[model samples]
Target chain A: MLVIDNLKASINGKQILKGISLHVKEGEVHAIMGPNGSGKSTLAAILAGREFAAIDGGSVSYFGRNLLDMAPEERSRDGLFLGFQYPIEIPGVSMVNFMKTAINEHRKYRGLEPLSASDFLKLMREKKELVEIDSTLTNRSVNEGFSGGEKKKNEIFQMAMLEPRLAILDETDSGLDIDALRIVANGVNKLKRKDSSVIVITHYQRLLDFIVPDVVHVLYDGRIVKTAGKELALELEEKGYDWIKKEAEKTEESWRVNPQ
Target chain B: MNGNICQGGLFTLQESTVSENMENDSDKILDEVTSGDYKYGFYTDIEADQIAKGLNEDVVRMISQRKGEPGWLLEFRLRAYRHWLTMKMPGWANLKIPEIDYQDIIYYSAPRQKVAPGSLDEIDPELKKTFDRLGIPLDEQKHLSGVAVDAVMDSVSVATTFRETLAEMGIIFSSFSEAVKEYPDLVKRYLGSVVPYTDNYFAALNSAVFSDGSFCYIPKGVRCPMELSTYFRINAANTGQFERTLLVADEESYVSYLEGCTAPMRDENQLHAAVVEIVSERGAEVKYATVQNWYPGDKNGRGGIYNFVTKRGICKGDNSKISWTQVETGSAITWKYPSCILKGDNSVGEFYSVAVTNNHQQADTGTKMIHIGRNTRSTIVSKGISAGVSQNSYRGLVKVLKKASGARNFSQCDSLLLGDKCGAHTFPYIEVDNQTAVIEHEATTSKIGEDQIFYCNQRGISTEDAIGLIVNGYAREVINKLPMEFAVEAQKLLQISLEGSVG
Candidate 1:
């Protein structure tokens, strides 16, 4: 369903994602794990078509099409979603208006008529139940004056509303409490289908326990250093990323000595 | 990386800068949207009685002679004309007003009415077609069914409706000239009582050559059954527009009055100087709303209207209330301040405004609330939006006199900028004399960031619609104060005026 080849990206001429590659098929979950600044969020931003960074070299293919050629809105209409790590606070724009406009726009792109007010309200109520977000949260402006846990849950709520083909969740569990984490992970699990895929990018293994990944990859610097089954998460949890960092450094030092 | 010189071909891989391309694309879209053509720039052809171009004693006398006014009104005009000669155009506003050649303007012009005036047949079919195209459902049966509109075309009130029902209720609604002929005592007593002829430069000019406007009076203890409206359109080319509106709510009465305007596209800048006066008696309430959408000239600012006017209301008796709501979105240059004087103890006054300037348009507008009576209260909310290369400013004042013990006031002013070229400013003046007076004021200025636009983009909403949504949200507090019918139109106007002007 998705293919990223040699995605070398940089921001302000400082290299972030250097020769990163990944592949995912339908109905599969992949976890991209790394230390604090391992280009995890940059990968998600690139896939979402954010233009803050310069794509030094990349060729992303989604559904056998050149993903880089599409605009951000076109990517969204084509069923690509990105759960922002830090959700933006837009004052004065209510959640109901924001969500309705978003859903109606998606419908329009698919050659469908807009939903009636009553039907839209019903849909909102159903999704609110799925994400456990109450009426008070959605009645106000989008993410304005919301707590950290509420913002995370709201993101999952949006994912359920969009029902995207491929969703990249970046640090969705960072600010959430235990209860919020369980609810957010449960919402993601419920929305998953046979034809959809999920990419969970995180700095910890706690979130992986709820929505377990089929495959896990350890990223260091910019490259994928290791790819293994889900047990790699439990192993990394018991022991920190020190071994992986030391080994990666040794490999770089040897490369500098041998030029190979 | 600073590139003093690319001497060794160190970093020449990319052909074009990616971020530059994106920013340029957004800026291009903004340009195209803001530069969209004005839709109501069409003209009409009709036979008319137009006076010669110039302003002098003879021209003022000629206007009075043509209207066949009584000697007292003529003397009033002459007095205002003489005072106007002694007063120079005020330049205290934050505007770059061009020197206006008063003699180069036609003082008076009206569409000729050959037949008797009470029938619709007296209105020219050509003018009717234009009105239909302008979406003015003048037909009482088809459009604005409950609202009565005294249509003013080219400074002459041509069509009047809903008067008989109002007459049964002891309410007088008619054109200014008709009021002068039928109720000269009322007109003489109230006209210039709130905004006198010696008020300002433009007020003096309007008083001297004012042709026609709407006049309304609600009797004591009576409430008007319908909304009184006047749709003023500048039809004749090069004719200076002078409109005067006088509304009086007698003791224990209630009324809502609406004023709207639009003008045809002209090559020369048209000067529009007008005055509005409202008098509220004891226990009376008056609500006035305006949606001014005159011609704002072309995108290059070649031609438009220079709108300068004086509007004021006085709460005369105790416990009276008055509110003013205006949505000003047109004109090349606008300089107006609608004010309220709280002279009655325990009276209330409110002002709500939304001013939008796109292309080369400029607007310097706000309101003044003067608390003169003890326990008087006032509220002011002003919203200014600037797009394209335009400039928008809000200048407001709130004053409490020494005698106004226990007076209170609350004022809020907000400005939003759409593009890098546009500018927004706020000038608030506050004065308090009595120690018991309480006042609160808040001001904020904001710009639409690219992140917000991109977030909407990611949700499948286009940039244009996103801008509309965001702007409407920003101005919701003020737009909510407009009357329902005008609220919807005002929203659409705000959207259309800012189509692609923001990046």
Candidate 2:
């Protein structure tokens, strides 16, 4: 359902994603593993339609349509979701109200009437249970004064409510404790359906243990250097990234010698 | 986001055109008006019967005679006008108001539309249509149901709505011009009673040539059923809007009054000196709110309104209370302090303000509380937001008189800086003549941090929404103090007023 070809992207004249290509079929989970500053977050931000980024060269297609041509809100209405590394605190805007707005906006874009107050509340209760979000937190301002774990969990709860076709989790497990990590991963597992896909971007292998990926790609220096199965994650965890760096250097030297 | 709450229905095409025009005109005017000169200084070609500027017995008498006021009110105006000559412009205020050409101001300008509407049908349609365009609901050929409004154009109140309904409740709500004519006894009894003629230069001037304003009196034991409102607009050039508003809440009575003001852009700065007095009797509560959007001079500091206002509330009877909540976002130079005099034991006074100054605007606004009775209490919350080379100062005074032994007060002043070029200063003078009185004051200043906006952006929220959220949060403490209906309106208003300042 998603296709990216020879995707090249840069922010502020600095290329971050260089000649990366990927394809994800429906219902598949793909994990992108990289060292620090491997353009993992950059990929997520580009998919979210953030401004001030030079495309350089890219053709991203989602659901057979040009994804780059759509606005951010339109992309959201098209069932594209990005779970931020750090959630925003919208003071005075209650969580219940925020979710209601988002849901109604998406519904409106789909030519549907807004949900009734009773149905909205019922759905909220259902999603809160699925994600184990505290009742007190939902009634307060959106993510304001929430702990790190609660914020991550809130993102998952929102993801459940929206039921996006494609979900990109950007470092969602960085700040979570063991318990929170388990709860978050469990929530994601419950929401996953045969038609929905997940892209897990992370620096560590801890998150992959809870939400196993169908295929894993190792990224370094703004480009993917290796692609492997889920077990490759454990291998990288034990061997560290020094081997990957040495191999990358050797490849570059051979390319220079061959002049290809 | 609630579809049910869209009472106004779809946005009108006319509204969009007006919005576009407002943007273009304001930008063009802002460019020309940046030099602190009024762009709307030129007058429209309309013949107006106006009294000469400069306060004196003659001008006061002329204004009283033009309005056909009673003999006692004319005498009162003459007396106040005479007393005005003895008072000087106060120098103690932390304001740098330019020297006003009082002699050049046309104190009285009537549109020749002074035929009182004996019945609502007699009202002119054009004037009624203007109010309709302003989003004010007025019944066809009758008064509105929920709100009583006094629409003042130039220096005179053209019409008043819902007078009969208010009168049925024994609550007197009418134009100041009509009050002087119909309720002369009440007007004379309380006129200048709190702020006398010699109170200050502007108050004295307002008392003298104040052509029209709103007057309200809530009867004993009766709560006003609707919000009392007044819309003051300055249409004529060189004519100052010196409107006076007086509200009296009798024993066990309650009332809420709201006032809004606007003016066309002008090239020469126009003077707008207003006085508002409120009195609460025993067991009474009075809330006075103002949303002032008068024209602030252009970014270059050209023509704008010089808003010098004196608003004072008197807690006269035991257990009485008064609250002043103001959201001031306009005016080129503002020098205002809505004060309260707590004289009765156990009386309460409160002041909540959100003053924003942008693009060369200057505002020196705060409040004063004089506690005289035992167990009296006062609270003041002032939020000042300054941006784009503007300057805002909060000058407050809290004095505990010698006999106010058990008085208490708490004050908090917070300033938010949008740009580094702007300035926010607080000068709080606390005088404790009574040893047993308790007084506390807190002040803080903050800027819109880049990290906060970045966090929101990472969540896919736009930059404008992020800035709006931060502003709304900073102003929640004051916005929540407003009535529910006004709180929503104020939130939207803050968003509109602070547009383009976030980036």
Most accurate candidate by TM-score:
1
Roughly what TM-score does model 1 have, to 2 decimal places?
0.94
Runs of candidate 2 exceeding 4 Å displacement = A1-25, A35-39, A50-74, A107-119, A240-260, B1-48, B53-57, B69-99, B138-144, B297-302, B358-360, B386-389, B403-406, B416-425, B433-470, B499-503
RMSD of each: 5.0, 7.9
- Residue A100, candidate 2: how far off, in angstroms? 3.6
Question: Would you estimate the TM-scores of all the predictions?
Answer: 0.94, 0.84
lDDT of 2 by residue, B326-362 (tens): 9988899999999999998899999999998878899
Q: Specify the CAPRI tier of model 2.
A: acceptable
TM-score of chain A of each: 0.97, 0.97
**After superposition, candidate 1 runs with Cα above 4 Å error:** A257-260, B1-26, B500-503
DockQ leader = 1
Each candidate's fnat, listed in order, reads: 0.41, 0.11
Please give the RMSD of candidate 1 to the true structure: 5.0
Range of the 10 consecutive residues with the lowest summed lDDT in candidate 2 chain B: B1-10
